[model samples]
Target: MKVLHVITGLGIGGAEQQLRLLLRHLPVRSSVVTLTNPGAVAAGIEADGTPVTHLGMTGNRDLGALPRLARFVRQGRYDLVHTHLYRACVYGRTAARLAGVRRVIATEHSLGETQIEGRPLSAGTRALYLASERLGTSTVAVSPSVARRLAEWGVPPERIRIVPNGIETDRFAFDAGARRRTRQALGLPEDAHVVGGVGRLTPGKRFDRLVRAVASIPDARLLLVGEGEHRAELLRVAGECGAADRVLLAGACEDPPAAASAGPALPELLAAMDVFVSTSPDETFGLAVVEALAAGLPVLYVACPAVDDLAPEAAPGARRIGESVPELISALRGIRDARLARLPLPAAARRYDIARSAEQLMTLYDQAVHGTPLPAK
Candidate 1:
């Protein structure tokens, strides 16, 4: 079927990258429309042989963009419209109805208890979300945690489908040659214990706490893989704690199968690390934690619904930690002193494989178009 995917922006964030990965495995003919900045992930998507259209939306209230987007959708005569992110959901769903497309789907990628996409949730925001939500056929939550949050916010339980965010598992498999090369390229000592975290360097992510925790451990280095407005503050925190030289704020790296010019892709960095840590106390799915588990690295996380919702045996290498710097430091020291070897790829990693997620999504697409009932979970 012909499907058009709409999103707020094609930047290097979790939702954007996830879309790129999903398109690679989906069986239907799919195109993309980005309402704003079409950054690295957009380029990667185009490189993978998909047509990407930039909607050139100036700001949130760009009323002019609505007509333009609606006109484009009508011209394409798409069989279905799938929207991602917040702004896209509101506008895309409305525009799809205007363009006479009835089968519309929205995937809520980042929804937390107090925030939607790192922004504080307000009464007006909820009203707008709920109002726009009615225009779509269904909403897909990336995890059971996000599904619960949506239901609590008044979305009908029947409208919410749990389709967990997935990864190209084999792409993240540990590689010995990549480990040595990546460490040397990043100027890390071969014997030094590397503590790695991957996410937007945001205040909510609590990466500053990770820096301080790594600082307390002598000879430990911090490798943060994403970029954000919080970068300067994190650097200042590192310098204040006298760990400036021990930290590497490697700006956003693409997911694996990335071009050589994109610098070290995420898997290479994962290969060079001794342990993975997620300082964010509020996470929808904890996708990075799953990726780390696929790399066979032991994980210490403050919050990971992806792992927490699963049975303990699903991810034996992952450990949930408390939300304090002292607790983080102690956990790091414990893992370091123990010199834990890389564990086996856990069942959680296999469960969230991208191919499986694509199959589940295709089932939803079939249900939407053919009036077929979804199979029992």
Candidate 2:
């Protein structure tokens, strides 16, 4: 079946990476449409043999994009239209309906209790989201917490499908050679205690807390991977915490082929670190947390209901911590001298394997198209 996937932008991010991974494993013909900013992830998707079309949407007020997208969707005659992220969902669903594509679906990749799209919640935004949601046949929630949040937001429970975000388990497996090479490349001592966090350097991520936490732990180094508008602010915060020299910012690792490799990419970076920590108060699904688990590293996270709702067996090395400098410092010191065991990946990680998720999504697509019930959980 032909499926048209729409997304707000093709920037390097969890949702973009997840889309790339899904396209690789999906069994049907697929193509992509990006509203704007066809960055590195778009190149990777094109390399994978999926065609990508960019709509040059200047801003949210660009109504012309609707007709253009609808025309493309109609010409493609796709069996399904799937949208990701917010702006794309709003526009794609409407375009798909205008194109007469009855099988429409969207994935809720980011949503938190207090924040929607990294901003404070507002009534107008809620109305727009709810109104656009009606144009789709189903909404895929990346975690159970996200599904619950959607239900609370007035989405019918039956319309929400719980499909967790996934990763390539084998790609992220720990490698000793990678650890050595990555540490050497980053100019970090091989024996230094490293605390790693991966995500956009945004205010909502609360990376400032991590900078302060690293400062309290003498000799502890911080490695933050990913980029955003908050880079300058993060640098200032690091300097204020007196951990500027101790912190290393690798910027955004966008190429999935390189990122998936054991070479000095994201996998190596994750392996080089002693532990992974996340201070973000919200997430629809914690992709980095799962990647860390797949790499056999212990994790400390705060306010991530996505991870908190997981069964213990799925992420055996995960530990919950608050987003405070004191708590993080204490946690770092507690794990400083301890030798962490590299355990087999948890069943929870396996459940979200990209290949498995793709197959389940195909099932959901069948249900959406033919009104068939999903197989028993």
Most lDDT-accurate candidate = 1
Work out the TM-score per prediction.
0.99, 0.96
Q: 1-377 in candidate 2: lDDT tens per residue?
A: 89999999988998998999999999889999999999889989998899999999999989999999999999999999999988999999999999999789999998888787788877887799999999899999988899998999999998899888888878888898989989998899999989999999999999988988898888999999999998998899888888889999888886366235443678889989999998998877888988888888889988666567877766778899977889988888887868676667777667768888888899998888777888875
Off by over 4 Å in 2: 258-263
Q: What is the lDDT of residue 132 in candidate 1?
A: 95
Question: In candidate 1, which residue pairs get closer than 3 Å at backbone N, Cα or C atoms, i.e. clash?
Answer: none
Output the worst ten-in-a-row residue range by lDDT, candidate 2: 255-264
- Whole-model lDDT values for every prediction: 0.94, 0.88
C-alpha lDDT (0 to 100) for residue 137 of candidate 1: 97
Q: Superposing every Cα of model 2 onto the true structure, what RMSD results?
A: 1.7
